[model samples]
Target: MRSEDALANIDVAVLAGGLGTRIRGVLGDTPKVLAPIAGRAFLGHLLDYLSAYGSRRVVLCLGHLADRVTAWLARGDSAGTIDVVCQIEPRPLGTAGALGYVRKELRSGTVLVMNGDTFLDADLRAFVASHRLSGAEASVLCVTVDDASRFGRVEIGPDSRIRRFLEKAPGSGTINAGVYLFSAAFVDRFIAAGAVSLEADVLETLPPGTLNAHIAKARFLDIGTPESLAAAASVIAGRES
Candidate 1:
C-alpha cells in the first residue's frame, strides 16, 4: 500500500533531546537538531520530511537548548503541526528512558519514533501502515549497512519478526535506522516496567516475534559527528541545488 494511505493514522515523535556531545566541536552550544544542514536547520528538514509522509502531528523531544528548537518550530512555515515538549533528564536515561518521560503526551494508536541525529529516507507512512497490519507490538525501521558494528543490528526470522537485537556487531547486517513504530500496548508496557534502554531493557522482555523490522530502501545518514555533519551539509546542499 502507498505510504500516505498507511500513515494516515500515525503520530510522529522526533527524539531531539540528546546532548550531542560528539558533534559539539562543530555545533557548540547548539542542539544537534538545530544544527544547520544545507540552508536550514536539520530539524526543519526532518519536519518537512515527516509532513511529506502524511504526518499530521509532530511531538519534539527536547532537552539541552530546547528553547531554540521551540522558537524555530513556533515560527511555522508550513511544516505540518508541531508540539515541543521538554524531556529534561535528571540523569542520562538513555534512548527509551527519555521516551518514558513523555508517556502522557503519546495518545495515538500508533507512534512513529525517529532519531533527531539521523536523516532517513524511508517512507514513514508506509512503515506505520505495515506495523499496524503486522499485529506486532513494535516495528523498527532498519537498513542494511556495509558496517553494522557501529550501530544496533537486528536479525529477522523467516516469519519477518525480529529474532535478535545485537548492538554494534561487526560485519554486514541490518542496523537500526533510528526509527520505530510502537503500538499503544507497547507504550503501556514501558509505563509498567519503568525500563530505560529500548533494546536492552524493554525489547528484551518482549517475546520473540513481537517486534517487527522493516528495511529501508533509501540512503541513510547519521550526522552525529563533525565529519558526518559536514557530509550531511553536502548532501543537503546537493538536494537544494
Candidate 2:
C-alpha cells in the first residue's frame, strides 16, 4: 500500500502535554504546541503536515494549558478539514504515559506518534516502508545532526536495529527525531502507565534488536527553547511552502 494509504488507515497521536518550562518565559501561558509560528499556532503546521500525508484524524494528547489548545482548535483556523480531537491528560503523564492514557481511543493496528514541539521534513512513505520491512514492533525516526549535544543519540546497528540510546553529549551523532511508529500492542504493553517517559523509561530500556531505527536526512526543528522557538517561523514557512 502507498504510504499515504497506510497513514490514512492509522491513527496519529500528538504528545502535546509537556510543561513548556524552557520556553515559558517567552510564551507565558501559551502551550508549546500553540506557540505562534508564522502568525499561526505551531500545531497548525503539524496538522498540515499530517494532512498532506492523507491523515484524516489526529488525537492530541494535551496537558499543561490544554484548555488554551482546545480553544484554539475550536476556532478552526489551522486545522482546515482534518478531524482533530483533544485528549487532555488528567495530569502530567510524561511522554509514554500520555499515550497510554489514550491508547484505548486509538483505532488502528499501527499508529504514528510525534512530539508536538518538533517537526521533521521527512518522507513518511519511506519511513513507513522501512518499518514494515523490518517487522519491528516500534520504529524511531532518527536524523543525523551537526550537533547532537542538545539531544540524546540513538545507536543503531548495521541492520538498522536500535542497539541502545545514549545520553546527550557534545558531538555529532544520530538523534531520535521524536517521531515514532508503533504497533498498538507495543504501546499497550510497554507504555501502559500514567507517569512514564517514552524516552528514558521505555525506548532506552527496551532490549536491543527489538526496535527499528528509520534513518533519514531531514530539516528538523524543535521549539522547546526560546532560541529555537524564534527560528521556527522561517523554518515552518519554508517547509509549508
Candidate 3:
C-alpha cells in the first residue's frame, strides 16, 4: 500500500503507562518513554520515526507519570504531521488492559500496538502488510535474536503462525519484538473482556492460526533499565547517522 494510504488506514497505540520502576533508581520521577536520550525526550525520536513513515495518528496509553507524558505531548514534540492523543490510566493496568482503557480513542480498522518502553526499528508498513496478508485477527512482530534467553523463546509454525511463547530462559530463537497489529473486531472483543494481560491473557490463549507472526530482522532496544538507557544515545545516534 502507498504511504498515504497506510497513514490513513492505520492508527498507532503506544503503551507508555509503565511506572519506570526498573530504572527509577536512575531516572527517579521520569516516565520511561520520556527518559533522556541524545539530548531529547525518547518519545520524540519515536514520534519522528513513525511520522517519517506517514503514521498520522497515534494514541499514547499512559500510566505511572502519565501527567508528565501528556505534558510532553502538549509541547511541539509531535514534530508536526503526526497527531497524538494521551489517555491516562487511573490505576495500573497490564498491557492489554491498558488498551481496553482507551478503546474509544482507537479509530482505524487496524491499530498498531507498540510497547511504551521499547523501540523496534523496522518497517511499520511491512508489519501492517504482513498482518493483512496473513488475514489474522492479531499479528506480532517477531525477530530471531542471537540470544533469546532474556526474552524467552517463540515457537512459530512453518506457516508463520505463532505456536507457543516460552518463558525467560537460555535459548536463541524468534521472539516477540513488542510490536503488534490488531484488527478492530478483535480489539473490541479484547477490550470488552476487560483487564487482561496481553501476553498471559491474550496472545498466549489465542487459537494457533488466529494469532500470526511477521518476522523481521530489526534493531530492538528496551530502554527501561539504567544500563540500556545509558547505552541508548549511542544506539540511537548510530541509527540517526
Which candidate should be chosen as best, given lDDT against the real structure?
2
The residue-by-residue lDDT of candidate 2 on 102-174, one tens digit each, is 8877998999999999988898888888999999989999999888889999889999999988889997899
lDDT for model 1, please: 0.76
- Cα lDDT of all candidates, in order? 0.76, 0.88, 0.84
Best by TM-score: 2
Task: Assess every candidate by TM-score.
Answer: 0.89, 0.95, 0.95
RMSD, every candidate, angstroms: 2.3, 1.4, 1.5
- The ten-residue window of minimal lDDT in model 1 covers 77-86
Models ranked on lDDT? 2, 3, 1
Summarize candidate 3's per-residue lDDT along 75-158 as a digit string, tens digits.
777568878888888898889898988888998888889997887678777877888899888999988877677685778888
How far out, in Å, is residue 44 in model 3? 0.3
Off-target runs (Cα >4 Å) in candidate 2 are: 192-195
lDDT of 1 by residue, 1-241 (tens): 5655554567777778888989888998889998887878898788767766666776677777887776776677436554444455565666787778776777788888888899977766667666767888788888887777678778788877888777677898888788888887777778678887776888766777888878777567899988778889766655445
Task: Report the candidate with higher lDDT, 1 versus 3.
Answer: 3
